[model samples]
Target: MTSPPPHVAVSNYKGGVGKTSLAQGLTVAAAEAGDRVLVIDMDAQGNLTRRLRAPLSPNPDERFGASLADVLQRPAKGEIERILVPCGYGGIYSERISVAPTHFDLELLARTAGQAASERRLLRALAGVTDDFDLVVIDTPPRLFCHLIDIAWTASDVILMPCEGEYEAVEAARRVKERVLEDRHTLNPDLEIAGMVVSRYRSNLTLHKQRAKEMEKIVGAEGICPTRLPELVAFKNMSEKALPIVECGSEGRHMASLYRDVYKWSRDRINTVMKGAA
Candidate 1:
């Protein structure tokens, strides 16, 4: 079996903090750079799957007929590759991105995940099929201290934290950081915390500013991303239309440029972390 590419988990264990958005943005960055990227939706809400409008033909060679649930729960070793549907957006990156979808029923896997062997399910699933991609981006769920998140993190080489500038968001990120520490001591000693990204930030709000500062302390000033994404209608519009900022024409292109450095920086961190482990 071929070894999988570096799997970066875009997560913060906080809901509504733009984790999926960041995952999509990362995929866009990979695709724009002409890299074959695989996006796996680990959230039971399946927001990422629905946003991508999966089951569409990615290419004429293979068809997607399974879900993320099938990849983990089913005994089939080939399940992972079978579920790689194309993401909805088919612009210039049409051939560059693939998605493994999920739905609400994915919640059913929680019990299975609680089992002792479940922690390595994602890794087992990916062992046979990840050579086709340059990188793997897993959109983790908001729920924390659970088997699902445990399995995802254990499978990842790096964890990319994305949070909102809010009290709950900061608290949740701290919880995740603590869990990651436990991970380093136990399940995945090589797992690295890439950095923290604060999204939906409002510069005018004192609470937002304070929370951002608190997050900076959590990841260190240099560990915090400088591109604080504000609450913008454009982001909402792009998400509703299921389009990555890079595909929305001039305005989208301009907005995506703001994230260019951030994405590259995160990617660099991911690579560095992976290489160090190697």
Candidate 2:
């Protein structure tokens, strides 16, 4: 029997949003909850990798080694173990999270390969090590680049599209949904959207709550996450510290609790999806 796919991609077409933070939150939450999680930093900006403090090569052209770009170039023959680096902040309760680090040079991989090949590279690279992690969370680039397309096609078992509380963000989610549908029909038949998460919610702003309600109407209530991560200083602080909110004490406790809510919701969604498929 074949093993189950171990990938989930967090993507959004809009920039300056919380795509990276959501990905980091999920990875950290899953790991702390006793699941071995792996994060693939697919964005060329390297924000996720840098936040996690994973090592990267100074040389960009190295082949089939630690970088995600190299692994994608020749995934069938490369060892996944060699590429994952342990990333955890120093603390008594710091959770162990591993990542496949990548560099901005990864953008070149998408440019060189044809559309189909570029879109499938992440899926092929991930196939080599599905069993190693209970979950693999992918952080995709903002635009509809080849790497993002490949992530949509191969690596994603579920697409978690995070939208800010804005009209534009809602529309972008719809576009991403359309792309996902195309991907499901053509590339990964098993792919489904896990849900749409509303991030950076500020109850004080009427526009934020109004847009969020409109988004729910568009995406449906079943796809909405129960917990709305409030705009908090701790989130920014944690990023600066390269640590999950859960790792930081008093200042971050509330944010950590919010993350836990998302974690339970995600776990439930995964179980439901697996059972429904079975």
Candidate 3:
């Protein structure tokens, strides 16, 4: 039997660090590599959901019938499989990638999920689908929703954090380390940081360069990714159109390569760690 797919949570406490961009790119690349991919959009903003055309609704009760909110709030056998909808726009991997889209009610659910059993609810729900995909990428809400973020971290084997090259983003990267330690101690002992990718980088900015160096110190040079995603207009254009970078015009094709490189780098790191464990 094939080994279970790796659950990758592309997370950051700070917003606009290219978290969603990275998640979408990684899932697309994974699918291209012959891995059936599933992207779980845990962010209430539904940015990933909209881009992937997974499913969406402002009304929780109405969307719960086909959104992630239902899987988390009301668990039943086959619920996860039933909610998975295939990608409608990913390049080449459009059919290979699947998504568990989000609903606006996710914000409320995060607030009311209660402390007890908050983390495991997602893990339990995902148990049935572990073998269904080669990779599971979770696009999380930035900062505001801790409970749902915690669930993503708990169920994940590796967390890939995207940090913008700046002081605040660097500080956030440090806090991410602390959160990982806390989770290892109290929640998921197997949880680990796959590595940190410096996104939205501009080569000419001195402060950006300085903070990128600082981030390397925090996660260690080994944990810092070599391929950095440059600040490009293509990202915004692609996002606005609700299309994957790979599917965008030729410019997007070039930009998509950078993101895919990071995914391959991250996948190699995860595989190395899993092999060591075995």
Candidate 4:
């Protein structure tokens, strides 16, 4: 018997913590590792969707087709799968990563989100297609309050917060944990903080090193990922080009390796939790 695919939400209340970038990298890494991955762009900005559609030059303002907002407004079971846009770029994986792209209308979804019948709208939609993939990565908006974030947390098995080694980043991670705990007690008891990744880390800086150590203590050693992702210009360039950092070029190899290691660690963590539950 096969267990349902794990839903991992790459989330942080703080913006510009490289949250979307990390989400994109992890999805690409998972796909290359032979997991059929689905990226759900829950951000109203649509950065994840735009990056994934890059090189193809999608119009950011236009609603190309059915988007996340559309699904949330009328979340019928299996409707999420119908909006999946195939990533045309093929390299490391035999199967291309698929994304449920979002458009500007998602901003509308965020504004009038309370109109939705249930906070579990996303959970119900995803449940219909759990057997189709090994993993589902949700790129949530950078804010803590909102129905969209609620939906993401409700649907997710593990919430991975990618924090930079900075004071604001650390505080943001703490707030996210508090929010998740609130949701767990009141809404979704199954949700867990699988782990937190210290992203864009600089080894030589005392501040960065100290913050990573502190986060490890807060989340426990196992909850903090071993590999620290370095800051790289290639990440931004790859996003602009609509390509995964791993597929960008030789310059991005090192960064990609770090992200891949984190992805593997996350996979192991989820499997361990699932086994314990079994």
Candidate 5:
């Protein structure tokens, strides 16, 4: 008698805060922990999709059959299950993770997402796949006005926001929280913004600490995660190979440990939220 796992979303209104990296790292690490994780790529850029090695790349020679766009517009029984494909990239636990991928076609959903009940489309589509995985992680678009973010927000039980150590990035998190709080009230009452995960942090720098304090103002002392991911040149290079930091051998070990700490924090947050629901 296994209960359905909760859906989690990774998002930020600002771009280039290592949002995709954080998403990829968490998903793979979750699978490494022996949990079956489903990662939904709601971003049109499809960076997570590429990292997971799911088909339907940005430019493919042959057209792939279905994507998140098709499912959102016309959700049917088992449609999400049919759309989900294995993540063949992660060394041993790769098959434990699955992906409901996105592409440029997803941009069409953003323009027309204002239709009645449109925000609930993702929630409706995911209903039939409750027994498929132990947890679901969604990678949302970074733009403020994009409906992909709305779709993920509506469907998620908890969301993780990532921000770089900068004024603009921290401000973006504040603005996004203000907007999504409205969405939660109107759309899904159970959804919550778990906390903010500070990415690309430079502890040796003074200004970065100031930026972190500014973020604390937005999410509060408890709302900010304790473990922060540091900026690494290898992280940039790992993106090319689509490897999670933890599995990249020696060079990635440092950042990998930081990511594991964040993972534990997220797991605790999710548990607390779910227990409250119970």
Candidate 6:
């Protein structure tokens, strides 16, 4: 019997585009829906780590006790539970949600000159662990590096590309799709794009609306999520409080609704992909 593929990864090569926020929202939504979920911080900036209060390090070698870096180096010995930090809301710490914390060491790994077979490190590290959770959403870095490529090609069964509904962002999505196809042909043959999501949308802005239409043309209407997240202050508030929007109170209700849409869309995509594979 074959194991199930991990849920998906929210990734893009552009920074400051709400990648981490989307990851957190999806993880929280899934957990709240009673699915065991794990969020992996794969960026060197460690925004996710800081948000969850995970351990940090000034140097690569001195980071968290167990991290994605450690798992890459020793998959057989590394366990997700060892590195995972539980993020609770209203004093809740259930098995529904966990985070595989990372640190600056990720950048060190990316910069290493002689890192042979590094492209497959993440794949090996995550082996034998997909079955442990209902989903494992990875927050990839904003640049193309060994770690990003490795996770994109090896670990990701589905890719969720988030855009800001701008021409530049749409162009970036095109490039990302091309890269995904290229990687699938060579490394991970089963990889597929789950869909595209428009974040920070403002219907009052003609430019934003036009760009959204253009993006739908590029990725297809069905490939684009129907629920576009409006530009709201609530998201920023969630970030400030270091909590998922769902747990942030009545002010966060809008953000929580957006997360529910994402959770439903992602679940449908995963089910579709699984059915196709079967």
Per-model lDDT: 0.77, 0.75, 0.79, 0.80, 0.81, 0.72
Which runs of model 4 end up more than 4 angstroms from their true locations? 54-65, 91-94, 111-117, 274-278
lDDT of 4 by residue, 202-231 (tens): 899999999998888667888898988887
Model 5 lDDT per residue over 1-278, tens place? 87788888888888899899989888877877778888899998888988888867444523234688778876765577778878867555567988888787788886677689888788888886868788889998888766777788888888789999998999999998788677678767887778889989999999999999999988778878899888887677657788776667676887777777788888887787667765
For all predicted structures, in order, the TM-scores are: 0.88, 0.89, 0.92, 0.91, 0.92, 0.89
The local distance difference test score of model 3 is 0.79
After TM-score superposition, the amount by which residue 77's alpha carbon in candidate 5 deviates from its true location, in angstroms, is: 3.5
Q: Against the true structure, what is every candidate's RMSD?
A: 3.8, 2.6, 2.0, 2.5, 2.0, 2.6
Give the range where candidate 4 is weakest over 10 consecutive residues by summed lDDT: 54-63
Q: Deviation in angstroms for 28 in model 5?
A: 1.1
Off by over 4 Å in 2: 1-6, 59-64, 90-95, 115-118, 274-278
| lDDT, candidate 3, 1-278, per-residue tens | 77888888888888888899888778777776778888889888888988776765556566777887778875664467778888887455677898888867677676655767767767887876868778889888777337888777778888788999877777877887787886565668888887888889998999888988898787678788899888777878777887777767777898888877887899898887666655
How many steric overlaps does candidate 4 have?
A: 0
Candidate 1 residues 18-73, lDDT tens each? Answer: 89888877787778777788888888777777677675335423322366665687
Off by over 4 Å in 6: 1-5, 56-64, 88-94, 111-116
Instruction: Show model 3 residue runs off by greater than 4 Å.
Output: 57-61, 276-278
TM-score of 3: 0.92
Scored by lDDT, model 5 comes in at: 0.81
lDDT of 6 by residue, 1-278 (tens): 75564658787767767788888788788877877776778786778766655555566465645676666554552355566766645344345667777776666565543567566566666666666777888888876545555654576778787889777778877877888776676557777877788888888899998988888876688778888877787878777777778667775887898888888997897677657765
